[model samples]
Target chain A: MSDSCCDGNARKAQAGDCCAPDGNVMLLSCSGGSNVGQLANQACVELTQEGFGKIFCLAGIGGKLSGFVRSAKDVPRMVVLDGCEVGCAKAIFKEAGTLLRGYVVLTDLGISKNKDFARKREDIDQVKAAAKQASQAQV
Target chain B: MQIKILGPGCPKCHKTEEVVREAVAEAGVQAEVTKVTNTMEIAAAGVFGTPAVIIDGDVKVVGKVPSKEQVKSWLGK
Candidate 1:
């Protein structure tokens, strides 16, 4: 629903329509039950909105949906964002049998994991920075 | 009939619920529509995305909120 005229007819479009041609790069994020997880999930949404990449559905992959698993396997590049050291995003990739690339962990960036921490703009910036760095490192 | 709208209470999820209710009323079916907010139960129901619909234990929609007409068709009206 980015455009006012977007009546959501493009819901079935390929993820690449929002990202690189053919959707070579995929973004997966952990929406864990913690504040950091929320931050990670929010960052992915913002990143996708900014056209950094298409945010693939992590829950779909976690649910082991065949289409989602197949799509992730087809992506040549992927960024997995985890809110904490628990690495739920990474684990989803592993469970789906897809190779992980451009991984970024919020806790690795010194963000503390807590159940009650407020999601700050600064935290999202930190995750975005780390994600950008990982994408660059992939080059 | 039992209908479960699954999500973490996001806007789109709410919209889906609204549409499901409308569809049920329009179809004139005696259906109980439930909103599932629990993440674990959502996943357990085979919904990997938010704003999904479950009809009688079968997943009928996922990730997107369908129109009233579409929902009614799914309800077999």
Candidate 2:
């Protein structure tokens, strides 16, 4: 089992592990070079596929694009996903000052990082279930 | 080079990833493809929509997935 990583363990909160309390949240995935990173990607895909929420962009947010930044700034909530514990996803929003609504870690799902970039079908499905669960709990 | 695909794994995101893979093959370039989904991570990457593409860490497409030719052009391959 993993640690609770609550506010008490701020630094312990990996990229996709910390979450905020607002609604209208957006999901951001690390999508790095690992099986779990792809899992995080799949989770957001499933959530968007279900129409539960729309997937937002990280580059636009990172580059500080006016429309992207303004829209995110306006949104009441946002979420970041890190495939692993590297926290690459969280660092992006952290720099933008946009409120992070939620955080999730793919490794927490038991998928480890890897050099292989091939995303598996089962992996995506499992991550989807996790994303739905996370979203339901958030609401 | 950096390759990014937007969308939360919806059909679009998946398709974009496919397109990216195909484009990479067509170009014969060993590019690193990344799929970003975290909201904060996405925000941090500076994207507001999903099913997007980033080439060399630079945003090339967003809001919708582009065609392989489009991706190729974006990559300037």
Candidate 3:
């Protein structure tokens, strides 16, 4: 049987080959120029550093770079984190015709969007928890 | 010209390959279409996304499948 055979890899159609090297979940953040946006960005970076996921460039994807777009489409798992309700990160993927396996919104977690709100550890922690929860959801 | 499509044999990748073929035929351009499905090669080619087009070893298009006109234009036809 082929390595991509459908034995135990049921999510293959939605995700890529289960045996592929894309085990690292791709994480994207809006990272807008705001307080909550900054928190989302920091949380994604921490998640990457912690080996929970790999922070990918939303710009590259938005720019419609073929490789980045293709990778996003075929990645085993992808998590999109947005600050506030703008959902820019999610919009980028949607515009690029990519599917996100996980999604998080900071504002929904009681974090208000403001230009002056400083990124505190507590808020960051909350964002991290939301992201983790998103990644664990059955897509 | 050597036209390479970087993808992982996904549906979109296959679609890109087909589009390239159609574009070449429509433009009547003398070009070779290559599909690079190996993840490592795609990454080495600086493609973090799929369904990208590389022309003469230089990345030209990425992410979404290109339109026929866009493909022809990239081929300089």
Q: Top model by lDDT, which number?
A: 3
DockQ of every candidate structure: 0.03, 0.06, 0.15
lDDT of each: 0.71, 0.63, 0.74
How many collisions between residues are there in candidate 2? 42
What DockQ does predicted model 2 obtain?
0.06
Worst 10 residues of 2 chain A by lDDT: A1-10
> Which residue segments of model 3 deviate by more than 4 Å?
A1-20, B1-46, B49-77
The local lDDT score (0 to 100) that residue A133 gets in candidate 2 is 65
Worst lDDT run of 10 residues, candidate 1 chain A, spans: A1-10
Candidate 3 residue lDDT tens string, B23-71 = 9999998898887766667666545455678888657665566788888
Expressed as tens digits, the lDDT of each residue in A49-136 for candidate 1 is 8877667688888887754664565555667888889887888888878788899888888889898958999999989878877777
For candidate 2, give the lDDT of residue A59. 68
- Against the hidden reference, what TM-scores do the models get? 0.54, 0.49, 0.61
Tens digits of per-residue lDDT for model 3 on A1-139? 1223112334563554332324566778898999988898899899888878778888878988755776677666777888978789888888988886688888988888899959899999888888888777734
In model 2, which runs have C-alpha deviations exceeding 4 angstroms?
A1-25, B1-77
Candidate 3 positional error at A105, Å: 0.8
> Which of the predicted structures, 1 or 3, would earn the higher lDDT when compared with the native?
3
lDDT string for model 2 (B1-77, tens) is 77766444455567779988998899888788877655555555554445456676556654455688987776678
Among all windows of 10 consecutive residues in model 3 chain B, the one with the lowest summed lDDT is B42-51
CAPRI-style class, candidate 2: incorrect
lDDT for position A99 in model 2: 66
